[model samples]
Target: MQQSKGRPRTAGAGQESSAERLDGHGREPTEDAGHLRYDDPWYDALASGWGESAGAGEPVPAVVAAARREDESRGAAADVYLEVQRSAAFQEVRRRYRRFVVPACVAFFAWYVGYVVAATTAPELMARPVAGAVNVAMAAGLGQFATTFLLTWAYARHARLRRDRAALELRWDTQELTRGVDGGAS
Candidate 1:
């Protein structure tokens, strides 16, 4: 319903009529009538950005779609970042290494100490080397080092894989969110 200056303001029949109404000629209303409610000018004024145009039912430009997609990719990246932060796989890998690595090392040292004591206390066993110059203590120590190295390597690999998976998930989610926004805006 368009209101105009000097027009009599009356309520519909059966509704109480107003004794006085503010006709559309308020100083500001006269100055901006073209941009009044229900007009394109008003909508344009409210729409200040590219997203606003999309909100106004305007066909978004291709560049806008691409930009939205990029934004979505970033959001996806953020999601992956969060998932990695929450992932049990990543936590478990770290936990396992902490729980077992030190204990294994301690056990190795204990075994070496025991072997050393046995060798010093019993020369018969020490004299009989398992392989030229390499007796039981040397063999056990070398084996312990090998096991430690392998465990460290395995834990590192597992942690790396978990991080990568989390990153990939975030990337995809960001892309999808952007795409959804683009479609709605367009």
Candidate 2:
């Protein structure tokens, strides 16, 4: 890295390089922006430096020791999750989820594609007036939006009514198994 005589000096050991700090649009990242979404399920807090660093890196020998320990712990944790996943309770919950989701997704896709096919292939039918200046195309287009909301509501309602309790119980069971407090805490 060649230092340009005219370039501004940046202090290390305190902050990342200004070039690295800039966002995709060449603008600096805003501190006030809400980056973490508590409501979101897909947020990766560990990878995002939310709480702390990956420990045991200060000493050279401890890093090697920690690496061995980490590998063992990871394998054991993986096995526990794999075991829980293969359990009948987990399978039942998954089955219930799939039972509702698969059919609902298929039906919704069919409905949407059917509408598109009707609009494109059968223009005369779509153009047929339902009421004063309100054609079948308009009605069907509106039906698409209606069905979207209907399906969303139905999915949520079904999950809450049928699967939520069983899924919650399954989650609790998995958590308890993973806690491993009896001299086996990983």
Candidate 3:
């Protein structure tokens, strides 16, 4: 009996018409193209492994299945914990800003509105100053700019230190993964 060839030959030769119709020549097909399935590679690999196992006269053992289950559980737990830590850090930063930055910004806007109203309504009073050559509005506005700059500079320094610490921790974790001493596949 003659074995039929797999997959039909269309109206094209190698690396010419069919290549342009898909991606470039030598590119693999994608899932949406409908010519191939998503699990093709994994299923093909599994089928190939079955041939090897049959030749060796051994089936899959139960201990390997149990170990794989345990490994999958541990991996899922690690992923969940990492996600929690990431989200917790984000929430903490937002909480810190909410506790200080939000109220400060609201107070600043309120003060600004008050200043504009007072400057428009009572220019003579605002122009009078406690110190030489500096009126009350000028002093207050200058104080606001100074406070904003100091806060921004301090926050920048704090953020840089925090990021450096986080990076160092991540580097250590990555080093541990690279060592592969935890019985995990690299």
Q: Which of candidates 2 and 3 reaches a greater TM-score?
A: 2
Per-residue C-alpha lDDT of model 1 across residues 128-176, encoded as one tens digit per residue = 6897888866776687678678768865785566555655655566556
Query: lDDT per model, in order?
Result: 0.52, 0.65, 0.54
Question: Measured by TM-score, how close is model 1 to the native structure?
Answer: 0.30
Name the TM-score of candidate 2: 0.63
**Cα lDDT of model 3 by residue, 30-115, tens digit:** 66788642221222222323212323434223233446665675686576456545765545655664666577677778877887
RMSD of each: 21.9, 11.0, 14.4
Which digits, one per residue and each the tens of the lDDT, describe model 2 over residues 1-186?
212332333555355554534322112346665442222233223332222222422211112444556567667667778988898988887898899999999998999999999999999999999999999999999999999999999989988998889888877776776667323563
On the 0 to 100 scale, the lDDT of residue 39 in model 2 is: 22
Residue 134 CA error for candidate 1 (Å)?
3.9
Candidate 2 regions with alpha-carbon error over 4 angstroms: 1-64, 181-186
lDDT of 2 at 138: 98
